[model samples]
Target: MPDWNLVGKQHVLAAIAECDRLGSRDFLQRYRFGRARASTVWHRGQEYDSKAILGVAYLHATGRAATADDFTRGEAGAVDLLQGLGFDVVVDEEALAAEKAPRVRKTTATKPARASRSAPAAKPRRTTAKSDERVKVCPTCYMALPATGICDNCD
Candidate 1:
């Protein structure tokens, strides 16, 4: 009984079918667009660009986004209208919730020496600014190597 508005005619039909298959009038609700930003809707953790929505619709309808660019603003408007029809669109919130679920696993116990060996070797400890004065002199010409770890003028 909701007021369907901006979506495409075919998109409306598909959302309706999805709603029926999912056994929830709210299925289409998962695809709500904001009043202020008609071009965006939630998808996973990000805002799905309007183009992506068409891409999604294309994928849903034809297994690919072959003609996604063909989805016009009017079509997007039609989709908005269909959402107004009481479809239970998920709006990315559920998707994010599912991702945040706690996962359990076994903990590893390693000897300090073994763990240290597995750990990446600590990067050579950086010397402080005070240490710059103590740079190693080149054996050939006594020229100092800039902290660059190399003597550019020498080799």
Candidate 2:
């Protein structure tokens, strides 16, 4: 709950509504005017506490506040009201505990498998003189001509 004394009642109400709609207390704090100041405000010939109203509005907007009693009892009352409305109050402890537990890993050291011996590499075949004689240079493009003796580039 925050103070609403320094800021206008309408502004405080708007901030509370916005906070409730968003379901975020941080949003309210960030957008609240005179966030550093706290003062009492007179509304409808009565003192309306900004912090209390904000808290109640938050509970109501979040579907936690069912009646005026919820506002009177504060957070615990709001929780009870919310529970009465069929909301699950218990969290899954088993799942959370499992998540926190450290994982176990098996570490085994073993010698690397021996590499199989490979056969000796064969020598590359040398190009014969007849192979060179079969190739001809194109006179038009000064490029190597294919077996058809046609200059693709010049054409």
Candidate 3:
């Protein structure tokens, strides 16, 4: 582990100056750094990333940049280090929740309930064999005629 004792307020200030001069994206790239997720350092009414600033400050102190794995992060880490230097380091609840929580779904319209039982169906009519015997067949025309023995086809 690199000596944390070497990091001073001047180094942190220089890192902040470098970040503002080069902009966050370029400054981070120059130092091989990423955005701080846990805590952000607030100075001169501007919010700076905690991890990058501290890591870059460590570089400013020793001329060699410290990676994320170089030191611990929260209580006894960057926060503690920055706090020792009298920097306002705030751990935003929103940032922590955003990193850990899943995506939220908006409430949608409720669907209509389905019927439990179906509608009553109509019953089919039944035909009997005795009703079929009542029909008379014509003799000459060979057609089923009325029971009066008169053939409509023959007439």
What is the per-residue lDDT of model 2 for residues 9-93, given as tens digits with 9 covering 90 to 100?
A: 3433543444444444453333232221222223334333333344434433332222222234333333343344333333234
Cα TM-score of candidate 3:
0.57
- Residue 66 of model 3, lDDT score: 71
Give the Å error, residue 8, model 1: 12
lDDT of 1: 0.39
Q: What is the lDDT of residue 91 in candidate 2?
A: 28
Q: What is the lDDT of every predicted structure here?
A: 0.39, 0.38, 0.72
Select the stronger candidate by lDDT from 2 and 3.
3
Clashing pairs in 2: 5-39
* Strongest candidate by TM-score: 3
Question: Candidate 1 residues 66-145, lDDT tens each?
Answer: 22224343334434433554332333444334534665878999756764447667888876542122334445433324
Worst 10 residues of 2 by lDDT: 31-40
The TM-scores of all predictions, comma-separated, are 0.24, 0.20, 0.57
- Model 1 scores a TM of 0.24
lDDT of 3 by residue, 1-155 (tens): 76989999988997787678778897777555678877889999988878788877876676566766676533237878999999999986676657555668899999776689665778988876331233344455323344567875677
Worst 10 residues of 1 by lDDT: 28-37
How far off is residue 33 in model 3, in Å? Answer: 1.6
How many residue pairs clash (N, CA or C atoms closer than 3 angstroms) in each of the candidate models, in the order given?
26, 1, 0
Residue 60 accuracy (lDDT) in model 1: 43
